[model samples]
Target chain A: MRRLHHWPLDPASRAARFALAEKGLDVDLEEARPWLRAEPLFRLNPAGGLPVLEDNGATIAEIGPVLEYLEDAYPGQPLMPRGAVERAEVRRLIGWFDVKYNGEVNAYLLHEKLEKRAQSLGAPDPQAIRDGRDHLRWHLDYLAGLLDERDGLAGPRFTLADIIGAAHLSCADYLGDLPFDEFPAVKTWYSRIKCRPAFRGLLADRLPGLPPAKHYDDLDF
Target chain B: MRRLHHWPLDPASRAARFALAEKGLDVDLEEARPWLRAEPLFRLNPAGGLPVLEDNGATIAEIGPVLEYLEDAYPGQPLMPRGAVERAEVRRLIGWFDVKYNGEVNAYLLHEKLEKRAQSLGAPDPQAIRDGRDHLRWHLDYLAGLLDERDGLAGPRFTLADIIGAAHLSCADYLGDLPFDEFPAVKTWYSRIKCRPAFRGLLADRLPGLPPAKHYDDLDF
Candidate 1:
């Protein structure tokens, strides 16, 4: 049996979960938070974060490896496309959302709005929130532009790229930060991906004292 | 023919260069500075960064995809080992250096000691410098502990893990930030990786008005 150590609302964890669900793999779940710096989590992953997977006597840590592991180990249902160049595009978009979009949007909203509250670090900085919200509009516009042309972020078929994009935007959506109305294509694209059974579990996560947005978890939204 | 656009001192670029060289692939070079935010660079990579690779009508941008592209397409001289779990460890180490190590050490030193001067972004914060330096000692020590146990950063054979670790530490080494004497195993590991023919070009790189640390290019430092 495979086991996954994860934290709800963590985009990396969500992405891993999405990958596993897409593969139709069954994994026993264990909750872990990086901020807590649990020693056992560190033992499993010296980098010390959640989304660590233990399968077949191997411990796979870090989100990138976790997804790649699933794709390679479970070659039954491929989240990645067939060609090498196409795979690069998918991976590039993964980097785009995981790093660039995360830096621009999630780092500000999630760290300030949710993480700080959980860790008792401090209240959200108004300036940071403003910057994040401003960046989110631009990102959503970009997403809409892409969805206008392609069926998915990387191409005509759904890939891990869409999974990562939705995973990140989901966190912002939970906080009522995503302005989907302004970007109709992205909203439509997101709604299609949202209804996927792989995404249902993540949409249902709730942080204590902070409820999700009104439209969050609404299939029609 | 492959064309790689890169900057000399960027850690991600260094990792890409190292990956290409390890694969023994020939690549035409174009120097790019992302801080300048050049339009052409943005066109090649929407994320707008260096180390963008163009190969046979395919534009692979971002370090992760670029490396994976080489691994998948070339497969001539394998930098990554066979087996699913082993590859995960290699990838995890790549994430360790690219994210954790870069955040703790290189980001401060690279921004303060090099980038700020290059971009005329005022001066480096003394506190950032101090925190980065303090973290460097801890990182080097941790690296030494790993080297003491394993042949390379991940295991017996060299992988992207060692390349990324060396690539990031090479930048820190450029700033004279690493205290090698306190971490012999890491220093030994560095000396071994540093002497490879793949690393020759990177060691020869020099920026105007900013020289590398005294031992930056030493084969047996």
Candidate 2:
């Protein structure tokens, strides 16, 4: 049996869930709160980060490894593209969202709005929120430019790049932070990915006490 | 002909350079400072990050994609182990350094010492450097614990995990920041990887004004 420990709204965790579902793998989901740094989570992953996967007695930690493990062990679904060059493009996009986007946008926006509230770490900084919003617009422009070139983030076929990208954007949308209408191309691409069966569990994720935006779950917003 | 645009002291760029050399692939190296964000660099990689690889009409940007592309395209020397589980471990370590370690240690230490000095951003903050040193000790203890069990990181084989790990640690060493005497196991492991041929180029790297630690290139340290 495969068991995954993840937080519902964590973008990395969401990406892992989406990939597992896309691969048609059945997994026992365990909710892990990263802030707690629980003993169980630390034992499985010394790093104490979320989205750790235990499969066939082997445990894989972090989103990068979990996603790569799925591709390596379960080759049936093949979320990665065929060609090496295309695969590089897909990985580049993954890094863009994982590192660049997380640093520029999520670290400010999510940390200030979501994590601060979740951890009861006082009120959010307005200046930080404004900075995050500015960065978000720039990121949306970059995504729109990429979408203009192809149907998906990487290319014609839907890949892990799209899954990871949507995972981040979905979380932002949940907080009512995304300006979807401003970038019509990004909005269109997101709307298509939002409707996927793999994304169902993610859309259903509702953080307790603090609810998502009104149109977050709407298919045609 | 293969060509790599990189910054000498950038940990990610060092990983790419080390990986390329380990695979016995000779490439022309061009220095590209990420802070400059030159148009040529932006043209190849819109992200404008250091360590962009250009080979055979294809340009791969960022350390993650560059390393993965090398693995996918050139499978001869095989830096990655054969098993899926082992591969996951390697990737996990990569993420550990890339995300956790980078965030905890480098973001404070390197950004204050190296980046600020390079960009002429002013004097380094004493508190941030102190915080980085404190966190660095914790990281060293963790690495020491791992070395006590395995001959090399991930397993008996010297894989990409060691390459990436050394890449980060070496940068700290270059700045005379790492306390090798405190963690002998980690030091021994560093010494072993330090003696490799691929490490030669990295040891030779010197910033125009800032010199490496006296023992930075010393194999017997």
Candidate 3:
């Protein structure tokens, strides 16, 4: 069995877990605090981040590597599309959510709403909260726009691109950050994703004091 | 020929350029200002980012997707290793450099040293410069440690991992930000990479007003 080191509310960790569950791989979970730089976590991943997977002797850290490793090592359920061009689209959207969305939205929203609490930091910055909300509107619009071209964010069928988008957005959603009414297409697409059996785990994860949005776990909203 | 829209000094663009050169792919380079989010650049990539690749009808944005497309489509000059674990290691290092190292070091150093100059954003923050230098020491040490286990950064064979690393570090090197003497192993490893014919184009790249460091383009620095 493999062992995964991750934090529950973290988007990367959620993606890794969801990917693992979607693949039907059994793994024991261990919580890790990357900021603490605890001896074991540091050694397991010199990069000092979450979603680190230790299978036998191989320790894979970083969501990019872990996601690819799952796709490559376990081909049971193909998260990546067949054609090179299609796969590039999936990975491109993955980058969009992981890099662009995370930077613009979650970096501010999650940090303010969640990580700050864990680190015992005081109140979230009003300006950063405003920035997060502002950036999120652009992302929601982009996601909704992408839906106009295809059934999913990246393509006709679901892929890791969708998985990653949901994971990242779920964080903001958990903080009641996303305005679903403004992005009807994204909301519809997300409703499909949120209802997946693999996503149940993500929906269940909650921070002690930070209650999720009223419709966060609801199957239909 | 494929076309690449990029900003020369950006590490991600440099990585894409170096990856193309390593793979013997000929691409006509068109410089784009991502910050400006000009009409054409935004049309190519609505995310408003650089290192976007247009091949045939497919437009690939972001270095992450571009590198993978090159490896998957053009197998002639393979930049990735054969095994799953090895490929994961290579990707891991790419993330380490692109995400961790870039955020901690280059995001500060490069933005301050280069992008700020381009945007006419006034002077670089001295505190940011100091912090970038401070963080770079740890990365150099980490790179030096990586070289201890394998001849190259990721493994015995040179791969995209090396390309991304060299592409990223070259930014600070041009700015005279790195202390090569302290990490002999990394310095030696970089020396080998810098001497590659593929790297010549990067070495030759010089911003108009910003002449590179004393030994920036030197093979035996």
DockQ of all candidate complexes:
0.82, 0.81, 0.79
The candidate that achieves the highest lDDT relative to the unseen native structure: 2
Return the TM-score for each candidate structure. 0.94, 0.94, 0.94
Ten-residue stretch with the least lDDT total in model 1 chain A: A93-102
CAPRI quality band, candidate 3: medium
The local distance difference test score of model 2 is 0.91
Q: List where candidate 1 sits over 4 angstroms from the true fold.
A: A122-127, B122-127
- Mind giving the per-residue lDDT tens digits that candidate 1 earns over B1-221? 68999998998899899888988888898888899998999999988886899999889998878888888998887778888888888888877876788788878888888889889999899999998999889888888788888989888888878888898888888888888888888888999998899999889988888898999999978
Instruction: Write candidate 2's Cα lDDT for B120-205 as tens digits.
Output: 99999999999999999999999899899998888889888898899999999999999999999999999999999989999999
lDDT of 3 by residue, B51-134 (tens): 899998899987888889989989887888987788889988887887789889988899898889999999999999999999
Overall lDDT per candidate, in order of appearance? 0.87, 0.91, 0.88
Q: Rank the candidates by DockQ, best first.
A: 1, 2, 3
Expressed as tens digits, the lDDT of each residue in A122-148 for candidate 1 is 879999999999999989888887888
Query: For candidate 1, what is the DockQ-based docking class?
Result: high
Give a tens-digit lDDT track for model 3, residues A102-175.
88988899888788889999999999999999999988988888999999888999889888888998888888
In model 1, the Cα lDDT at residue A114 comes to 82
Could you give candidate 2's per-residue lDDT for residues A65-154 as a string of tens digits? 888899999999899998889999998998888888998999999999989988999999999999999999999999999999999999
Model 3, runs deviating above 4 Å: B125-127
